[model samples]
Target chain A: MIGFIIERIAFFAAIGGAGYIAFKGFSAIYRNIMLGRKEKLAGNLNTMLLVAFGQKKMFKRPIVAVLHFIFYVAFIVTQIELLEIMIDGAFGTHRFVYHLVEHIAPLRALYVFTVSSIEVLSLMTFFVTIIFFIRRDMLKIPRLSSIDLEGWPNMDAHLILLMEINLILNIFLMNTADMAVSNGAYGLWLSGIFASAFAGWDVEILHILEKVGWWGHLAGVLGFLMYLSISKHLHILLAFPNTYFTRQTPNGYLDNMESVTREVKLMMDPNAAVPESTEDGPVKFGAKDVTDLSWKNLLDAYTCTECGRCTAQCPANLTGKKLSPRTIMMKTRDRLEEVGKNIDANGGIWKDDGKSLIENGYISVEELRACTTCNACVEECPVNISPLNIIMQLRRNLIMEDSNSPAEWNGMFANLENNAAPWQFSQQDRFNWAKEQ
Target chain B: MQVKEMAEYAASGETPEILFWVGCSGSFDQRAQKITRSFVKILNHLNIKFAVLGKEEACTGDPAKRAGNEFVYQMLALQNIEILNGYGVKKIVTTCPHCFNILKNEYPALGGNYEVIHHSTFLQQLINEGKVTMAEGGLFKGKTITYHDSCYLGRANEIYEAPRKVLEQLDAELVEMKSCKTRGLCCGAGGAQMFKEEEHGRIRINEERTQEALNTNATIVAAACPFCNTMITDGVKGKDKQASIKVFDIAELLAAGQGLENIVL
Candidate 1:
């Protein structure tokens, strides 16, 4: 009795510690997102439902989609089992929910059915995860094997798969060990076969085995929960809000700079009436650092799955230019995280670190210039993340503020300024084709 | 062929059914002019009552805006809008996807709104209305022609079918590239890259896309945008395949199939 009571106390302590750490980790991410400039993102329920919950874009590759769906469904269904484990550990009793509901025959049958289904789903999830591992390592899929995922990203993926396997094995261990001790009293469907192997084993030994399973499974779940905030696995939670908050405009529309629009309208006609400015600081042209990007852009950086789908479809990447869209999102997230740490370390104020997203070790001028703005990457993202927008934001700063466009682009701009076309032909001669024909 | 300028229509107290926006490439490029004339020939045959903006039309500033020069983009956009609004132009059609995209999608935000249509969609409407009758056993009859999807036209605006439907009217076996429609690759000319040298790379973007078009084993590749036409034409030549595999604009193909373009080939 005393051991059971002690075990309950230990479970609570472990869970509380993990829960607090997870809360802190997630709060840090929220602060990092809030460091960005403000832009309105109204709720889009329909987009959220279709793209995020339905995983609509994943269906483009049907085989992998099926594999992923099985893993997702398995994870959700296992939460029911998780709840029963929590209750059993807290109350110093084995299978507490089962015991409470075992009296009503129909409810008992419901319990049996639910546990059996979870076992079958778990067994399937086990295989699917292994296949995903094999696909990543052995299949040599170009996107997965690209230089973008060479070091820590690759390790992150392997660790996630290994953790999933650990969680799954511990479930079977707890169930099968319980069946061995209870002599079929539990009646969990698939684990019963393994339970028979311990028919005449010592009861105390079986009890110890069940205890180990209980503790291992509980620890694994809590640990994974905490780890998600620090890992790319955050996508499992972020995909929902990211889809809802994605910009609602057509994929091609870059919102006009309100400042630039005001200048141009006034220039075109001196009598042009413009709205009064709401000035807090001098208006900067475009994004020079993480702080200049909108909050949603920062959120997009966190939500990236690092799946490399966008990189595979990018024209610049295909033609061997320096740009890879996936790398753009990854760099943004890295820089944002670094900036968040800077704020935290300096008495809650941001201090310039002499680094920006576009120079000397982050996204580069060559990468920014290489983009064709073709919308292929935008079209391919399953989570509705737009790396193209980030690239354009950085390019806007380079051009409008630094005047860093190429000589060829400068020539084009000059021609448009004087001749009203990208070339040097006179506006009066626009009809030359008609006359010459 | 005779055409009336929008200024003439305004002076005569008349309004044409549509304003034909002749983009800079269509006005000045030697090859694109042939495509312009072909579309004009078809419109004249249909008696569509279209008027050109002629010399009064400035560039739509597509390249400038895409290159991150908002100042230049808005400068040209507002200038053109003043003239368009002054004449009360109600409808517009253009052969270039860049112009069509900016005019249709971007202009409204800057106070220059009109009913805008690409020539592919416009030509498709003509076909659907039973006006663009194809001559039996026309010039491109039974030929294998694959259609290239222009980035601004196909993906940006999602008007893939109109160009393909127009190609189907040629009585040709219309094929598709390996990357077609939504997954279509760029012709390496978007985002103002046409005016600048390409970045250092293993190969050019246009050649990569052109190889996909060639893989379909079609005798000809059809394009909807003038920029795509130029890029792919250059791409085909880079392979030294011009003698066997030709690139033509959808407008030129449509006119040639009707025996109306007076095609030299």
Candidate 2:
């Protein structure tokens, strides 16, 4: 009775600690995302289904896609079993589903089917995680090992893979020991193979081993849940909502600035009402930092899987330019995190610092200028993230607000302003080529 | 030049079937003027009534928008929208993909809406409706002609089939570069890159794209966009293969195949 009370106390303590940490981390992220400007979201259902659930864009790489699909499906399905584990841990019960299985005939069959499937999936998950480890650590695939992924990003990937391997192993070990103790036919296929190794062992020793496996598996999962908020693995939870709010506009289309459009309309129609100017409230053009960007862009930064698919498919990156689309997303998230920390330290207010995302060297002018606006990065993102939009927004701040653009671009801007074309020719001479024909 | 202005057509109480949007390149660049003339020749041969904005046509401000000068883009766009709206123009066709993209995709957001068509798609439609005809055993017949997909036309607007369909109508064998249609590489000239020196890189994007075209070994490389034409032409010259590989716009090819080359001049 004392041992049972100690087990329950330990389980509740673990649950409370992990829950507190996970909640605080998620709330911080939520606060950071709210700092961005408002944007209306539409077509959420289709985008979520096609991109997050269907994994449509990921299939561009067939072999990796199949392996990832198996792992993704297994991860979601295993949560059902995790729920049962939670119930068992709380009640000090073993195999909570056994009670239901004994009462309903179909429930027994369903319980057996689920356990058998998870046994196979657990093995598949182990194998896939091993391959991921090999790909990242051994092969050092360029996308996986790019300079941007050097410190924590690299270690985070390895830790997740290692943890996954450990978690699956413990789960399997627990099931094998359970089947050996119960001498049950359910979950006997794969577990039976391992159960034979323990046939000569005492049943009391097997029960202790099963308890160790059970406690360790639960602890690992709780730790993983808390770690997710800081890890790139946040995509596991954020990808669905991120894809749902993705921009549905045609990739080639650019949004017109309402402020600029109002000026243009005033120019076109002199009779248009000129609204009175109110007290100044940050009348800057385009994005200078995370605060000026749309909330969807902030969501995009958090949802990035650090997959480097965008960087790999970027024409500018492929041509040896300094622009890595992956880096753009990473830098945006980093700046947002810094700003979040600043607001947290202060009394929920932002104090102007002497530094900013551009001038402080988070993203350089060379990186911004190197982009060709090819939309290739946007196209290749599995979750519909648009690093091109972020790059363009930064470029707008560089040009419109700072008047800091490349000399050639300044000349082009002048030509467009004066001659109504990109060339030095006068607008009157626009049709001269047609006259020659 | 026999191009009539919208004002001229309106004074006579006449409404043309379409407005020919002579973009900056089509109106100013010497080489692109030939593409403009070839397209006009096809329209004339089919008796499709069309008028141009002529000297009144301003740039579509696509370069300004792409180069991050939204102020100048809005200025130019608002002016052109006023001119177009004043004429009550309904349909527009252009040989330049840049203009087609801006006019069709960007203009509506600024309250300038109209039916805009790229000349390649327009020519394909003309042929489909039996308004234009191709002659048997034309100059391009039996030749392997590969089509270079312009970035604005291919990926920007999803117009892969229209140009390919037009090329198919010609007796020439239509070949494809490894990166064609939706997967097409840029000719290193979109996003206003044509006006500026390329950023420092290991290789020019057009040179790489050209190498893909050369690998196909097609005798004639057909392009639709004026910017793409210039880039591929320069790329062919860069490779010193201009003597063997010729670059022609789809409209120019159609004009030649339809025995309307004389009308192009």
Candidate 3:
């Protein structure tokens, strides 16, 4: 009679939790798809997935890569087992995966070992998250510091800490619950620990508490999964695509620009082809707003796990320039989100953000000029996110439209105008170096 | 020859099997022109008649295109394409990978279509077809050499083996830098930086590439692209070890196949 009552409680809780997770997951998936469809992605799926799903970029920094790989594998395996446990407990199935394990003792032993391994990994992840929060928040590593926000938002860091703490608490409680179930008088090994923890308690009360613990575990699992899909954790969606599109070849190779006449003609006639019009006059060349980006670039921004691999690899950043490639992507995202809100409401671009905002500050002209076009950041970016291309496009706008360029650029233009090259030397001297030989 | 004259010269006859677009690098870079002139002589020796684009040739816009200026690039490309089309040119041969890449890849975007081959690739084919043979007494026969892959040729187009094959035909011991072929670093002459000052970086990319070649102690550096040839030569000279090492373009090495009687100043 006690078992029957406990099973009934587990069933309803599972149903409620499952329904909530399904609704949130589907809603987030739909929203991201609709958002992506509205903008073109910069790269192909094969390339994006090569980096994103392949975890290609993260592996460049092996320590973080190993930690992430563990957490990723643990999360997947645990969720699958956790779901099976929920369904079997709710339906009172004598057999699920565990049934096959029963007939094969070795398999059962392997299953137990696997479950324990995932639990240990979860514990490590919990610890890593605490460390991650501290390094990013309290101590402040330059690489991990939030580029999106100015000054300290004490409450934001506190909130992140709280979220991680909540996840850890749930993990602790579920482990305790598993221990309780292993320790029962009926002596199911899985429930024996929990049953033993409450050896002095009445069997009836212990059973009821075990069922409650089961529901709590399910609720926490479902909630975290939903949160991961919706929040900035949206990198979960991006990781797959980033990995697939990563360049398999070397970094020195150039990403060839569209042929010149094709680009010019596209500007002359917007209807000629898609790429041509994208480079058209007065239209920002590299990227200004989120909509200017292809869906793949937006996906690249969204998929940034803030791992700081680009920051670590950037020679500019290493040489003490004010630029951080990771931060550039983050800032672009912050600007996009800020501008996206205004655009959605006003039915126009971010022009209403005030003249000074677009003309000078934020992504200033100096920042654009600072980039060396060496492609170190693009090469190091595991997800194949190209911060260089963005800088190039932005330069196009500053040069083409605003004419607010550095003096040297004008000199370069004059050089190319008079000479076929960008040097002050005479066209007659183009072969001078050859003559000396 | 200008593009128009080259076109006219090429079209006035039943189309020759190849039309060599001797870029300004070849026409004016003295040794490059000499080597190219020798390349012509060598082909003449092999009875492979070819048309050379002389004063009528125009810049390929490689300089402007890579300097982040697309306007001049468009103008030069369109003019070149019109000239090439007028000549009824079908297959193009050139020693400049920058020109080869521009003519082969970038030109198509502007609707210019013609088959393009780098000269090293042509030389390898000629040797493989047994159309040419090295005489016993050549300038570089006994030397150990290392070849610098031009950024545009090797990294841009993946033409790593052809130059090495050409070098091998002359029986020179070809060594490799630790980073060769597609993994090869830039000579700092690409992207029209050769025509302009290199923006400050922690290290000069050409110096970095040259130091690797020097580390090999190969005594000689052979190159395909004139830009690489110039940059590596400058780098070697800059290091003040100019007396220790020599740089030669690949065509010059092939020109060594010529007997004393065939030599020109």
Best by DockQ: 1
Whole-model Cα lDDT per candidate?
0.89, 0.85, 0.63
Candidate 2: pairs in clash? none
Clashes of each: 0, 0, 53
The CA lDDT at B34 in model 1 is: 89
Tens-digit lDDT string for candidate 1 (A135-249): 8989978898888888888998888999898888888888888999888877789888889877898998988888888788888899899998878888889999999997887
Name the DockQ score for candidate 1.
Answer: 0.78
Ranking by TM-score: 1, 2, 3
Second chain alone, TM-score for each candidate: 0.98, 0.97, 0.90
**Positional deviation of B239 in candidate 2, in angstroms?**
2.0
The interface root-mean-square deviations, each candidate in sequence, come to: 0.9, 1.3, 5.6
Q: Tell me each candidate's TM-score.
A: 0.98, 0.96, 0.69
**Number of the predicted model whose lDDT against the real structure is largest:** 1
Candidate 3 lDDT over A62-151, as tens digits, reads 877777776676667667567666656666663266666666878877766666665566677777777767777778876666463344
Cα displacement (Å) at residue A238, model 3:
1.3
lDDT of 2 by residue, B1-265 (tens): 4677888998999999899998999888888989988888888877778999987888999988887888899889988998999999999999998899999999998879999999989988887988777778867666898999887777677788999888887888888888766567778887778888878888887888889889998988899999989988899899999877888899998888888774221
CA deviation > 4 Å runs, candidate 1: A197-199
